[model samples]
Target: MAKEIVCRDAGYDCDFMIRSENEEELIEVVQQHAQETHDTEMSQEDIRGAWKTV
Candidate 1:
């Protein structure tokens, strides 16, 4: 089953939700979204730390 993480759940005001086949993929997409939308630089550890498996 696919997993998901919501930006709000990560303490962000955005309602962005990333769903993927695995946590790695989900983190990748989230990282890209963070950079493109939020203009924030997040490391793998930051993404993983904020991730809420759903």
Candidate 2:
């Protein structure tokens, strides 16, 4: 199944979502979006544990 994560679920005021064939790629884009738009840096582990990103 493809993985999807929503930025708003992380407590950010923006609504950014990414759906990828693999979790690794999804995490990378999510991290990039966070850094570029939110000015926040997060690791893959952090993203996984932060929410029920399914």
Candidate 3:
């Protein structure tokens, strides 16, 4: 099963899907989520850190 991570943006839960076995892919998914869904700008470093636990 794919691992899922929820992030809060604008006081809403932004659900992001992260497939296991790849950290980079998860990071990219999170970046897109933050930009398209959350409308919050995140730095590359922040994105990397977010996916660290997922």
Candidate 4:
């Protein structure tokens, strides 16, 4: 099944969503997005916890 992570779901005011069939890829994308766009860096575990499973 495909899974997605929404920035808003992670308590961000932005509406960015990351999707991937792979969990690691999803985390990588979300981590990068959080850093580049939000100026926030997150660990893999934190990233995993922040995203809503969809």
Candidate 5:
């Protein structure tokens, strides 16, 4: 089974949900979540590599 991580940041009411088939994917999701939802600066390659599964 895979794990899904739900993240929410200050100043935002909507919660960003991400599902990963593995740990690697979760990492990517976290980065994307931070960048897109949280407004944190992140790189595409870093996010891509963070994926654990397709």
Candidate 6:
């Protein structure tokens, strides 16, 4: 099954959400979103730490 994460649930104010076949892909999408939309940089560990599975 695919996994998902909600940005708000992870403490971000934005409503960014993503789904992927695996954790790595999810993290990649989240990282890209953060960079493009939020002007933020997150490491793999940081993203994983903040993620809330949905």
Task: In candidate 3, list every pair of residues with a backbone clash.
Answer: none
RMSD of each: 1.8, 1.7, 3.8, 1.5, 6.3, 2.0
Clashing pairs in 4: none
Best by lDDT: 4
Which residue pairs in candidate 2 have backbone atoms (N, alpha carbon, C) closer than 3 angstroms, thus clashing? none
Model 3 gets an lDDT of 0.60
lDDT of each: 0.79, 0.77, 0.60, 0.81, 0.59, 0.79
Ranking by TM-score: 2, 4, 1, 6, 3, 5
Tens-digit lDDT track of model 4 for 1-54:
667788887778998987778988888888888899999988988876665555
TM-score, every prediction: 0.72, 0.78, 0.55, 0.78, 0.46, 0.71
1-54, model 5: which lDDT tens digit per residue?
A: 655544442334667667767666667667767877668864655555443342
Error of 2 at 15 (Å): 1.7
For residues 1-54, write the lDDT of model 2, one tens digit per residue: 667777787777887887677777778888898899988899988877764434
As for lDDT, the candidate ahead, 3 or 5, is 3
Tell me which of candidates 1 and 3 scores higher on TM-score: 1
Instruction: Quickly count the clashes in candidate 5.
Output: 3
Q: Which runs in model 3 stand beyond 4 Å of their true positions? A: 1-4, 8-11, 17-19, 52-54
Error of 5 at 53 (Å): 16
Model 5: lDDT to the true structure: 0.59
Cα deviation at 21, candidate 6, in Å, is 4.2
Could you give candidate 1's per-residue lDDT for residues 1-54 as a string of tens digits?
A: 666778887677998987777777877888899999889988888877776555
- Assess the local accuracy of residue 53 in candidate 4 as a C-alpha lDDT between 0 and 100: 54
Candidate 1 residue pairs in clash (backbone atoms < 3 Å): none
Q: Which clashing pairs does model 5 show? A: 24-52, 25-51, 25-52
